[model samples]
Target: MNKSNIYQCADCHTGSGTPQALQAPKVRTHLPSVTNYSCTDCHSKVVVNAGPTAANVTAHYAIRPTVPTSNYCDYCHGPNATSPFPARNKTIPQFAHDDPGWDGNATCRTCHTNSSVSADPLANDTSSFHELTTEYGDAFNGSVKADCVVCHVQKSPQFVAAPNPPHDISGMAAPDCYGCHGVNVPGTEAQKLHNPTPTTTGGCIACHSNNATRYYVNKSLFALHANVNTTDGMNNVTDADCKTCHHGAADGTMGMKLGAANSSNTYFCQDCHTSAGTGPTHPSDPNLIKDGLSHGKTDCRWCHLAGDSQPRPLSSQLRYHPNGPRGTAAGKNCLSCHVSANLPDPPFHAPGESHVSDLNACQECHSNADNHAVTPLTQNTPPLVSGLSVSTQITSGTPSQVQFTVSDPMLQIAAAQYQVTNSSGIVFDWTNMTGTFNSNSVTINANIDTSGLVGNYTVNVKGMKSAPRTDPSKPYYPLNGQWSSISNAQLNVIQPTGYDNGTVYGTLGTDIAGATVSTNTGVSTIANSSGFYSLSLTNGTYQLTASKDPEYYPNSSVFVTVTAFTTITQNIILTPKPTGNISGTVTSK
Candidate 1:
């Protein structure tokens, strides 16, 4: 080939001199025709084909023209094609195309060599078909990677479906389908191998049906395992258990009378069993047997076995009810029924038992006969009179004397004795007299010295029966009753003469000035400065009149009296002012 005709070689070649015309220049008649291999080899550095196969030899081939031709480097390297590669390939190489280098397998250097290219090809051309991998980098590996199923056909198994439907007996086509339906769907061969009978209706019964001894047979077989031997077996059963299957049980059933039993068994058995009742017979009792006082019965559950469905007891045959086995006569003695053949010995009172006296009947100290009674030693003893009084009189300085009186009017002196103590607590007198007492009055001339004793003093009188007093022998003292009496009178010791001083002091005022003074039975004075005055008087009444002054007329008069030497204060108001008036008027235009 001619030297100039090798327009662009694969690599730059330089020769010093044409060595002696090694051969005549192999010039062809046609200008150096471009061979497909030579053109591709040179342009491969600028633009490369993707998936180069025979079928896409010319169809998908990408070409870069020489610098000066109409297909110049600038022609292919314009703003739209600055990279000397196909516009489509330069922009979005991910999408496959008919042009060789413009197909989806093109890389960054294919067009970007010695050219300013976008760091991202899809950065400017929003309409490009390219999908930049960096935009979805994290999504490809993160939580949303599974979202590919929403678009691409090959990515369908990535996500789970919502609101799972009933499982098919055949089986799930996709294993990922179990992500949502596993909790609800029955396994394909599970029913055929485990529960072949198809007795249950849904998923719950599929596994639970095998343990018939533990669970109910099915939803329809409500009463299959109704009776449980122990409470633990029927763990979750409740009154709702009956309502679950007996929706129409209240209406009626074969061989079952409904309305008649509603009054007796309207509520759950546990409701009545847990509560107390006052009927003559137990509500759970079919025979209507009665026990206890008045033939009233205790609750049936008090002595019988309990069940889950029914609160009634299992046992029925017995002579007496378990509760309240004895009558009121037995009191709290349990042996009255437990060991009736030979009764146990009665309980005894210990050493400190209470004592009672024969003077009083048992009822006197034992208020209630139903229980044991305890009486104190001083039962029915009358309270002693701590003081005395009288409304009777005696001559002054006569040294009056009187006898002490007992309080209990039914007491007889024949069986009692009396003692008197003076104000100083000294035993002044005592006596053991004998008589039939009609009243509590006793009069004996007993002297009391009034010479030096002046102020009020108290005298105490005490009485007791002679021989530990079993009973009241006379009417003066009553059995089983407390004492009563009238207190002594309060004596006022008085002397004859009394002396008292008398004077009166007061404030004075007047309606007008200068009231006159008078000295009759009491002393009086006229008004002074600021209508005020002073007066000294004996114990008598007097009157004073106002003397008229030139500036004002006489206003009013007042009366005064004096009793003892006391200060009598009073306020007087004056009413002196001008009584005349004047009138006038103004003239206007």
Candidate 2:
């Protein structure tokens, strides 16, 4: 606390050249107590006025052992036994968690007058200890730090304070326990690394050895650990712990960063067990997961041995596939994450639904999956989609989201993806139409720019599936099917408004008012009594037809072309056939 007494490197180190072999602070450098928080480590501020000293202090000031030590606090808090407080140590008052002022910042000041005297920086620091209060920060009132509980019992007074970050993780008795098992100790990345045996018969080391230099290459030492599953208390296993002993990163990479570009990870399994090695080895190199697909998206343990003292299948030959396909007992045993009873997912798609079938692995579509091939409807009519339509506008120079609706029967609406060709005939991928998928109705909310768009734009929509997009720029797999109607719409950007319609005026000449006239796009209307009729359609070629009366023969269907919003006149001729024709049967073998 004495500024003049604080050691300054500048005292012996002039702005001149380097000193000889031995520095003046040789004695202090060897001192058992020099630390960043110690008086010897901080330079005296009295030299602040001298420009060279200030520059040296600003540029060269450094503490080798910067971390605060137990003795650092003794500088300002040395024992004052001559006064009222009875101190134990010759350098400072004896500190313990049980003191009356230990938990309260204000209460400690009552006894020690030094501004920093009561401020203990070691384990006695009170910040990590939460007090029991009405507004304990983080709603963790009354919670005590594991480090404190490891050594001391709760004091007379209780206070609320948030526990230190070191002790905040769940399933940990104390942060100190990280040396052993770690996360999802019950089932996490560190769970596998969390094994700690109080007895000398350690677990992971039983099979894995780091001190390979220490003689025991004897098979007996390692073979014992092959199937023993020691948990990290939480369900997670720390990959770091695994890498610490196992030479997993022969390539020198650190994390298990997954992606197609990081393909080297695909060969990581070979670093340890080796190709010549045996059994359920890493599922790559001719992996259990086929195709250029990835199994990185899923938890590997989901399909591996899980409970009841089962050992990991030592060899791939001892594969564990507990289910069949399509919610049946088809038993091709995918070992998928689905419950053991029903597998291959439900309401499966037709074989052609997926283009990636060659990839043929569960992880292809199900791993961290989204977007699925909708169940294919046999025909594009009915139940496929009704009134497939949309309304759009350019708001604030940017095209507002084009809103469209389709009947959702199963109510398991996911998402919708679309594509459109602009006026210049340039085809481009539209934004993924994802957001709210209301039950019984699928709505697409998407935004597109139309400022440069001239002619007309055609938009098509398809339902999203649970399959993840392997190539995100394109579409998720199983995209071959799904959706009743190819949700299509034509909205003219700058073209003048015109009616796309035609008249089916030449009727059977009967009560034409009830005669039904329909267009190719499933748009249907009735004819007037004067045999006058018209068809409303978009700018496209369509097949035109008139429904036949109960007493008359059906009219022949005719193809017509319509553009923009235009009304075109077309004549339909209906001829009635004679009553009945005699038929004779001829047989040939």
- Cα lDDT listed for each candidate: 0.30, 0.37
lDDT of 2: 0.37
Each prediction's TM-score versus the true structure: 0.15, 0.27
Error of 2 at 345 (Å): 13
Task: Give the C-alpha miss distance for residue 482 in model 2, angstroms.
Answer: 5.2
Candidate number of the best lDDT: 2
The clash count of every prediction, one per candidate, is: 14, 53
> Residue 232 of model 2: what lDDT?
34
Q: Write the per-residue lDDT of candidate 2 for residues 1-589, one digit (tens) a residue.
A: 3336554544443234245423543322212242223333333322235654344443234433222233323333345432322222233233322222334332222112112223444333422211212222212234532232232223112322222222123233433333322211343222222132211134333322333322112223223122222343332233333333333332334221211112232222222233443323333334332223233222222223122112432221222212111112123233322212111122221122222223244444445331121122222222234454545533223463566665433223334667777566646674466655423355656666665565567877666432333243432223432344467777555532224333344344444445566766788777666656666555577776676576445564777777654666776665554568789999999
RMSD of each: 35.6, 23.7
Q: Which stretches of candidate 2 lie over 4 Å from their true place?
A: 1-277, 280-386, 392-398, 405-414, 436-441, 447-455, 464-485, 494-589
Worst 10 residues of 2 by lDDT: 320-329
Candidate with the greatest TM-score versus the true structure = 2
